[model samples]
Target: MKGIIGKKIGMTSVFDPGGKQIACTIIEAGPCVVTQVKTEATDGYNALQIAYGDKKEKHTIAAEKNHFVKANTAAKKFVKEFRNYSEEKNIGDTITVDIFAEGEKVDVVGITKGKGFQGVVKRHGFSGVGEGSHGQHDRQRAPGSIGGSSYPSRVFKGMRMAGRMGTDRVKVKGLKIVKVFADKNYILVSGSVPGHNGSIVLIQK
Candidate 1:
């Protein structure tokens, strides 16, 4: 697998060759530094630990400082490990957006935007109980009956109910790479990515 840590730069529309307007998410990917190179003999697995985004030295701890020092790079805000990396990259090496190309398919992993507390209508797309005419006061967004009267009287586990929503780690797969701008370290993906604008995301192929 080949991967890079990136920041979502928001969305935009571009015109394709056939004159079709394509909506895509702009991501500032890579120019990441490889912090560690784990091998099967030493770490019992092969993975490349890369770091991206600048972080303040004052906020960095002693151990983290030492780790970044070994990579000969400054402290980074995001770090990710890609197992079975296809390329042979050594410690302190740099990975850039050039690893990906236009029309290539990749997967993006990011945290969805936190919607805070939500109801079943927005959370699970549950249509609220009918019209509010028949003595229905706040039943518009209610979850209705939760459980049965008897028998399995308790509410069953994994029941879809209104609660905390979003802010979950989600992986969107098979998203096509619409364009790549190596000069700007940006890649336009052919779909919407998770998280809000400027959020960190991991692009993997």
Candidate 2:
């Protein structure tokens, strides 16, 4: 269970050896510094805390500033804890894009783009009842008939309806690593990842 924090750098198409075009998402991965190491004997579990991206000192609180100072690293914007890392690395160690190799299967976790206040037609894919004919002209995209007539009249819980869409913590599994550009700190993964451009993502293997 080795992973790194990265930024979504957008998507592009790459030509494979078979001359077929493969769509890939570009991510600017690591140079992540280990901020802390938790052991089972002390923290009741084993995990590594890694931090990525540069953050201003003014934006950091006093406790976090002291924590980063103890780790001997500058303030970072994103910090995540990963359990069952492949190797035992000490705090203050740096992990880079070189940790990933081309043609490896990995899982990417990220937040999806937010679509505020969506309708049931677009959000839940509800095909409205009643046709356009017979005086039903304007009810084409409406969510028809929510509750029953008499018994249990209130709307049922967990009913899919119109509301906010996207902006969810989504995990995409089994995405292949198409390329690794360690020199530039960029890695390309096959298929799409969650979130918009410049959003943070976690890649796990």
Candidate that scores best on lDDT? 1
Which 10 successive residues of model 1 have the least lDDT summed? 134-143
Candidate 1 stretches with Cα past 4 Å from truth are none
Q: Once model 1 is optimally superposed onto the true structure by TM-score, how far is the C-alpha of residue 90 displaced, in angstroms?
A: 0.4
Instruction: Return the clash pairs for model 2, or none.
Output: none
lDDT of 2 by residue, 69-157 (tens): 98999999999999978888998999999888989999999999999999999999898776899888789889988889796879999
Which numbered prediction scores highest in TM-score against the true structure?
Answer: 2
TM-score for candidate 1: 0.96
Query: What C-alpha RMSD separates each model from the true structure?
Result: 1.2, 0.8
For each candidate in the order shown, give its overall lDDT on alpha carbons: 0.95, 0.94
TM-scores of the candidates are 0.96, 0.98
Determine which window of 10 residues in candidate 2 has minimal summed lDDT.
128-137
Residue 14 of candidate 1: its Cα lDDT? 95
Clashes of 2: 0
